[model samples]
Target: MERTLLIKNMVCDRCKTTVLELLKTEGFKVQSVALGEVVVKDASKKDDIRLKTALQAIGFELIQEEADVLVEKMKLALIKQMDKGDADFILSKIAEDLGKHYSFLSKTFSQLEGITLEKYLINLKIEKVKEYIQLKQLNFSEIAYSLNYKSSSHLAKQFKSITGMSMTAYKKLQESDRKGLDKIV
Candidate 1:
C-alpha cells in the first residue's frame, strides 16, 4: 500500500533530494518525494520510525494528518508555480487543481499556520525577486513582469510594503546583509 508521510521543514528541492537519498539508503521503496511529503510503495512501522528519525536528524519532523498533508501539498504546488515565473496562475486555478474551495483552503491554512496563503505566496515571490535582484541579471521591470506583477510600480509597492525598503535600496545593500525568508519572520 502506498502511504503518504507529512514532513515539516521539507520546503525545497534540496530537502526532497535529501529525503529521497535517506529513504533509498534505508531500503524503503520511495515512490516520490515532494516539498512536504514522501510516498512509499510499501512501508511498515519499523520503516516509519527509522524514516522519522532520519528526517528528524536533519531538522525535519514527520507529521500525521491527511488534511495537513493536503494543505502542505497545496502550498508547495503554489510555490512551484510561482517559482516558474508564470503569470497564468490565479487563486481559482490553484483551487480547481487541488479540487478544494479556495476559501476553505485559505482559511484552514491561516488557522493552522497563523498566516494567510496570500501572505505566504507574497513572501515566496518576494524572496524570488530578491534572488533575481541579487544576481544583478534582471532589471526591476523584467523581474516584475516575470513574477506576474501588474507593473513595475505595483511590484515595487508590494516589495516596499513587505521589506520596508525600496527595491533600489535593497539592490544597493550588500548581498551578505540580505535577510532570508525565515529570518524575515
Candidate 2:
C-alpha cells in the first residue's frame, strides 16, 4: 500500500532534498517529498520502525498521531500558500482551501501549537517581509502591497509589533532577521 509520512522540520528545498536522499539511501522509494510530507509506494510495518530510526538519526521526525498529522497538514498548507506569494489571502480562505472550517482549524491549531493561527500567519509574513527587505528590490509600499496589506502603515504597525523594530531599524541592522518558512512558528 502507498503510505504518506508527515515529517516535522522538512521546511525547505534543502530539507526536502536531504529527506529524499536519506529515504533513497535507506532503501525506501520516495514517491514524493514536499515541505512536511513524503509518500512511499511500498507497504510494510517493518519499514516504519527502520525509517523512523533512520529519520531521527538525521534530525528529522515522523509524525504518527492523528492530531499532529492534521496540524502538519495545516502548517504545510500555510507554508505552501506563503511560498507561492499567495499568503496575502485570508486564514478562513486558507482553511476553506484545506477543506476544513475556520473554527476547527483555528481551535485545533491554537490548542496544539500554543499560538493562534493569525499569530502564526503574521510571523510567516514578517519573515517574508524581512526577506524582501534584505533583497532591497521592493520599497515598503510595494512590499506591503505584494504581501496584501491594506497599506504600508498597516504593514509597518504589524511588523513593528512582531519584530519590536521598525522597518528602518531592521534595515540598519547588521544582519537579516529572516527565518526559514518552516521555522516561522
Q: What is the TM-score of each candidate against the true structure?
A: 0.86, 0.92
Highest TM-score scorer: 2
Q: Residues 62-150, candidate 2: write the lDDT tens digits.
A: 89987787778777777778788896567787677778888998999899889988899889889889999989999999999989998
Score each candidate by Cα lDDT: 0.78, 0.85
Error of 1 at 9 (Å): 3.3
Q: Kindly give the number of clashing pairs for every candidate.
A: 0, 0
Q: Judged by lDDT against the true structure, how good is candidate 2?
A: 0.85
Q: What's the TM for model 2?
A: 0.92
**Per-residue accuracy of model 1 over 105-167 as CA lDDT, tens digit each:** 888888877888788778778888888898999999999989888899999999999889999
Instruction: Point out where model 1 deviates above 4 Å.
Output: 176-185
